[model samples]
Target: MGHGTNLLRRGPRTAVAAVAVGALATAGLTLGPATAARAAISCEVTYTGYQWGSGSGGFTASIAVKNTGDPVTGWTLTFTFPGSQRLTQGWSAQWTQTGARVTATSPAWGGPVGAGSSFFLGFNGTWTGSNPPPTDFAINGVPCTVNQVPNPSPSATPVTTPSATPSPPPLRIVISPKSIVVPEGGTAGVQVTLSQRPPGNVIVGTGRVAGDTDLTASAPVTFTPENWDVPQTITVTAAQDGDATDGSATFDSRSSQITGSSAVLWTAVERDDDIVP
Candidate 1:
């Protein structure tokens, strides 16, 4: 029967070129750019081309597929473009070439990538003449490390103990109530706790939370954590000072390198020496 219909159409076109790699994430941020530390699961690829004539042109390739090990579930990558790039179309997964060897797999929702996480596969190609870029890449078959964006190594024995970059996760500014009780001149407000939202202004440091004498704040405190999303108030006002015998004062909100937590405002002297006839 015509050789079994050409072996069932070449066995599903060689299993659709055979290539698959599901989503992977974890590896602690850092994906698609600026990366280092080899082994454990690595792969990188980036290609871009544009011509639009004579044989047509238009290319875009992005394959990261990293992991560092463990937590796979599904993945497969194989590359070979050297030149004549011709992928046609692609989205998140399912892609297959034939001549220049290209195959990516992962469909039906496509997902899975943890253990230092990494999973990126973009594609869009259609070339005819020249469209270099795609020297090497692999996932299921190993091989993949691309991502070298660091130059300055004359190598004359230069190693001045400077190769440790990974420190940015310690900024907590919490300043809520802590203690408040006002009813003399009346007025109490102290709130400051921004989780994440600050690319500019952050100057907080009021006064009066020191030696108890009835609150009185609103000093150089100007925290604009971009909008903080919510909870952003700092107002403490209480001053009666006739003394019927109820006294308490404290106002202290300090923040040097993103760390503010100190609030206390209590005052209840009542009437302020008066007789509301």
Candidate 2:
């Protein structure tokens, strides 16, 4: 997964160097600290506001929408006028004004903003006395960072970003028949399953219980798993002594080559096997 952040794409910044100082006021967008998210779909807007003299006849505002995290399909720009500024006309997109709130939607041609790319639009507005640029901006229902002008000129260095990568699922093992009882002279079969294919060959090992005088166990002490899809069966034969009253012996079946080596250790109740069991 890519972080979607890379070399900053420069079109036209919000800062107006050509306009005489004091004659125009910048949008003064706020570039707050980056927010943490499960998937960073961060977006940002850079605005340039030109005030006509004393903001008596309203002003003209241009906005460039940028995708800082992931790619976006379309944009629905929304903002609120701080003062009595009312939108008069807009170009490059269709806009709707509701009281002091305004919304702009992308036109038929442009709206898809790829990661690290941006688009811009401008609108004219009217004011009674005071005209102030909007402090908040959201695109497509997700709030975007309001980036203020760094200075008259943007930084020359390109921002380096790290790509995102997802983690793989963990390895698992399953076995059937946690415990068992063998007849006087009978045998039982147990199934061994793997969660997924092993990184390499896997081996199974069996250990005999101590002081098992009346019971004898016969099981495929060692095994080489053929594949992940197929399950391996281990036959366990036991010898029952009539002289002894139900003598019991226990055995362990474990994978020779497993992840974390000693992470999984399972004990069968009667004659059990496998990871889950």
Candidate 3:
């Protein structure tokens, strides 16, 4: 179990800095507070999931935490699985589970997340009955606003923007079942679509961001204005490894034409088939 650390502890200004400010005031100059006030820790978290099989099944969960307030030297995210989702393996953080509760602590090389920056962590789990996304999320004991990304339906219509500009909605690439389980010698697919229609032909590029090098995603797929609303599938294949442990990888999808639209992240877990009884 890893614990988060914050070197910037809250306290009073140093005496030497205060004395220098006092001298400056006597010289006809004013100085502000020696230490800047620390902003409250606030965050926005997005939870996305993808599942396969029936009855007792396996799924992947991807969580994105955006530091909306102050910079976090490190962070600990805690949440509960609405269903009987037991963690099998995770990446990008130190993961632990106690019954239904799950905790993810920042890794040694994954910390010091700055304000306005976001970090991603996910896991492969098993679930029973129905799988529902968790509504409660907290970072460093502070509650976070959770945004759930819903799966896009096949009959979904294209969103039309008005000619007269009002406040434009946040642009995003829609990826359904944002996570997948790829067997060590097999592949999995995820759908990619645009939240709104593009002006012309838009190219959707896919690439691996982090995780196991043995897992590879498909090449870039293009979606034109004529079929922007239709979902396109991206394939992820896992290469066989000698180890028996499952491997995970993160892939990103971005639209070449949609300005200000951030890349959407998805995770792939390799189901190692080399384990013996």
Candidate 4:
């Protein structure tokens, strides 16, 4: 009886040992892949200089994405602008604007971003109001701090008194081909040439024959008119034109004049005209 009892105890102990070993093996199998996955994925993005366009009067910032982690099938970038700077255009990714915040996502390309591989995206928009770029930015939800770029100093000082020799107006403006014809509800392209370069903070106003219209650019103070109702002569004016420090005079206008379907005759008013035309 004693021997039988001892044999039964030994059998159960052996069974328990086997079960413990099996559980450890299963745990090792489960953890190994997870560790490997983490090692394989990379998440680093590099920022290059922006490629500015002529519309919306703002700069387009470019960035490169390098996958350092396990192959990334997808990712997202979120950033905020300091002050009133806003994002108006983007490519290679979908963008959403909320207040001063902007977020971009990679949805078009789903193929794995293999380890060490990279991709690129850019954002374009108007600065509208005066403000600086935000210091904080993010990649794939990771926090990043931007290096602040120094602001350029103002070049021209206000003229205290009219010189005996009056200086020519800071900017000379000309409308190219002087005219255009576009279908009603369509857009007309107008080219403006400037005798002088424009200031960094320069603002250009659009004048049309009818209806309210707004123009924008990706480069500074340049734009294309979008909404038109009828045909009419349009005059565009530049304000706060800059001098040689920023660039040379003789800058071309990206957005100066636009006409509608119905031509409205515009005559320049002269000092001699008793009645303004």
Instruction: Say which candidate scores most in lDDT.
Output: 3
What stretches of model 3 exceed 4 Å from their correct place? 1-39, 151-277
lDDT of 1 by residue, 1-277 (tens): 9999999989977765553212233342446434522335554544333334345446555556667675665676777887777788877778899999988876768677777777777788866666556756777778776553232223313558887999766555566766656556776676866556666666666666355465566665555756654666776666766556445555566566464343333322222333243
Q: Candidate 4 has what TM-score?
A: 0.37
Error of 1 at 124 (Å): 57
Compared with the true structure, what per-residue lDDT tens digits does model 4 show for residues 51-106? 22222245556766666655667677777777666777888889998998888888
Predict model 4's lDDT versus the native: 0.49
Q: State the lDDT of candidate 3 residue by residue for 1-277, as single tens digits.
A: 1232232331233566788777766654333444333447899999887776566677788899999988888789999888888999999999999999999999999868898999999999887876778888999889999999872422223557677868667656899898899999999999988777677888888889999999998888887778988988899989889899899999988876777856999899999999785
Candidate that scores best on TM-score: 3
All candidates: CA RMSD (Å): 26.1, 23.9, 34.4, 28.2
Candidate number with the higher lDDT (3 or 4)? 3
> How would the candidate models be sorted by TM-score, starting from the highest?
3, 2, 4, 1
C-alpha RMSD in Å of predicted model 4 compared with the true structure: 28.2
Q: Write down the lDDT of every candidate, Cα atoms only.
A: 0.61, 0.63, 0.83, 0.49
- Residue 40, candidate 2: how far off, in angstroms? 5.3
Residues 16-80, candidate 2: write the lDDT tens digits: 44453424223222222343222356778988776654426656788888889787665788888
Candidates in order, TM-scores: namely 0.20, 0.39, 0.43, 0.37
